[model samples]
Target: MTDAPLIDPFQRAVNYLRVSVTDRCDFRCVYCMAENMTFLPKKELLTLEELDRVCTNFVELGVEKLRITGGEPLVRRGIMTFFDSMSRHLESGALRELTLTTNGSQLERFADDLWAAGVRRVNISLDTINEAKFAEVTRWGRLPQVLRGIDAAQRVGMRVKINAVALKGFNESELFDLTEWCASRDMDLTWIEVMPMGDLGNEDRLDQYWSLKDLRARLAERYTVTDLSERSGGPARYVRLEETGQKIGFITPLTHNFCESCNRVRLTCTGELFMCLGQEDMYDLRPALRGSSDDTALKEAIRAAIALKPKGHDFDYSRQRPDGQMTRHMSHTGG
Candidate 1:
């Protein structure tokens, strides 16, 4: 076995891996999935043990950061066991970080266990703070429940970051409100531009599209925004708010492309590897995972897939239409 690092064709070292544990989510966010979502059968999904094995292989291949994501990861049964298993790598200093992106629905129940498993930081998805608007956006989510969960996470000493999707007509009014809320709580805030993913029968992507360029300009009207050069191993470009002394991040996929320094890959629950988020190109690893009793074949398959990583994604909204729209829901790929 060669002890070589995982580097993509673009010469970018692949040190970050985001694994989607399940496609099923408790909340049907209007922008993420349909209200009536049909999820993958449980039998088809990889077992928790298989997920740990795949992730361990990546860690061995020089992947230092592992982010567990899902429609909402905490909802998955026996998920803590996987976290416990991965903590061994962290203890050994082989993995630098083990964090997750959640909707903050179940943090009240699992916050202690997550902290015990060595998770220090978390990213919570929240678009609005208004109760009525939150219900309308999440469809089945309760604003109070999520807020309580956030409180629980903080109580357990977890550093929480809020991730909000910048929707034009939906969250345009709450821009300063959300920013102030995060700043007051001492939590970092990142605003993401909506990408053209999935199909909603009535919800139009163009109507929902909100460029971060304009969002930043609006923020500049009230605050002194200064661009920062540091990255947090993700696509968000950050800026510091001088008055509030807080860091605000912008993920502008449409108006600006941040793919030149791409160093991450996503793994689905069913053992599929997506080389690029915007591209349909994928390599199935179930055969290698299930066929061998050893890790040789599985590692080879991962290396081969990484070699095919593309230069960048094609997400454009300048044509007055959702160009390069993906048929797969964002929930399916992992938010």
Candidate 2:
């Protein structure tokens, strides 16, 4: 092990990494996919073997948590096999957690094999529970399939979290309804505010952004919520149902940015390293791995990438998109 302390610029332990194995996704969600989008060429994306090498190096550098994400991770071929290779590292106790984030389109088909491959937690992106509205948002995904995936994941005893981006005019009204539904099943729910990463036509759409304070105000009218003293993964502000066993959270990047405590380094589909969600900086690791036998050089590149992480991001989406902000579609970047 490197034995280097995990503190970043803010002195917070940075140990978790979100790796986007592929940029290609099966569904075209409104937030991520442009109406007429062109995806990257096949040759431009990283191979599964490349992803495995990066994961191994990250573990060697004190990263214990690994979350596999993509436009949809399942869209990549031989994903279970990739996880199987990663499992050897996990089983040897080099990595503590192996998780995934998916749109749930193909989760049911892959969840069992994934769990068997050593993935213990899974996050499913299901914005709206309404079938018609879901179809409207996802454009190509069927709600039933998503729901079935969620059910299968839960039945398999995996850590299941439902991620919903609370859009202003679209699904904001369903916040409380979704919370209650989660309570019924003792599930975890994360309500994320929409960030203006790319374009969606309306600039003022961000003006309607709701903070965690706003969400708590609305939910307090029904159930009593108590804030948890212990902080868990990433920047999510968490609260537990006062009477029920459900845990509900809000990831309010727009109003209350949490970059100070961010412990993540996102790897893009083509093996580019993004230090922060809002910054456009990247270091090409694939070429280095291909050219150098210097493992130290590779780890140094990772360190340099971490050193360049922004303190936090400004959520002024109404203004022009930040210059050099190279964040791809949220799906592609593993939102």
Q: Estimate each model's TM-score.
A: 0.99, 0.92
Taking the tens digit of each residue's C-alpha lDDT, what string does model 2 give over 81-186?
8899999878999799999999988878987898898888888898888899998888888999988898888888888888888777777788877887777766
Per-residue accuracy of model 1 over 151-256 as CA lDDT, tens digit each = 9999999999999999989999999999999999999999999988988889888988888889999999999999999998679899999989999999888888
Model 1 weakest lDDT span, ten residues long: 1-10
User: lDDT values of the candidates?
Assistant: 0.93, 0.79
- Clashes in model 1: which pairs? none
Give the TM-score comparing model 1 with the true structure, all chains together.
Answer: 0.99
Give me the candidate number with maximum TM-score. Answer: 1
Runs in model 1 lying further than 4 Å from the true structure: none
Residue 52 in candidate 1 has what lDDT? 96
Candidate whose lDDT is highest: 1
- Measured on C-alpha atoms, candidate 2 has an lDDT of 0.79
> Once model 2 is optimally superposed onto the true structure by TM-score, how far is the C-alpha of residue 276 displaced, in angstroms?
0.8
